[model samples]
Target: PAVPAPPVPAPSDREGGRDDDTRDKLKQASAALDRRDFDLAERLANAVINSASPPKQRAAARLIHGQVQCIARNDQEAAQIDLRGLEGFRAMKQRLLNVCRKHGILGR
Candidate 1:
């Protein structure tokens, strides 16, 4: 009889789901922000930021979080978050910057 091949492993075994989980959280956060669900967006972005994700991923989360703050007119908080992830936001996503600028986080 021929030997059977090994079974394929499923994705997101929890132990190996750190990055994937955080990536999904970030996507959800962005979607929430797009939907103007600031509370949900902030919660999901905070989850990604507090996870053991790579620095780049965390930075992306910060960007979303900052946008939420800007939308809520929390300029100080948005500025602080922007400072934390300056390099990532330096890519100048016009819409994000515009939101910050409108809220005075990026200055007038």
Candidate 2:
């Protein structure tokens, strides 16, 4: 008798479905920001920022990542200095602050 072929794995299983979900969530969060839904945007942004994934995808998450850090810095005293020390953060610190200010997520 011929040997049976190995079963193929599903795409979702192979990809873990997490990255796609994160991307979708990030897009929704960005849309919420565009719609001035700061509260929802903040929630979604936090989810993406806190996700256990590589920076490549998270960095592409953009506005959400910014909003999460902005909110964290404003609400968590301990995170302020560390968040400020992030790469390219110091140079664009003022600009980021300005954005957060406009979003009402952070105080100037």
lDDT (C-alpha, whole model) for all candidates: 0.77, 0.60
Error of 2 at 26 (Å): 0.8
Steric clash pairs (candidate 2): none
lDDT of 1 by residue, 1-107 (tens): 99999999776577467778888898999899889998998999888878888887887887888888777757676556555674645663455677787877767
TM-score of each predicted structure versus truth: 0.73, 0.53
Give the Cα-based TM-score of candidate 2 against the true structure.
0.53
Give the alpha carbon lDDT tens digit for every residue of 41-70 in model 2. Answer: 767766776787566445444445465555
Candidate 1 lDDT: 0.77
Model 1: residue 49 alpha-carbon error in angstroms: 0.8
RMSD to native for every prediction?
6.0, 6.2
Model 2 lDDT, full chain set: 0.60
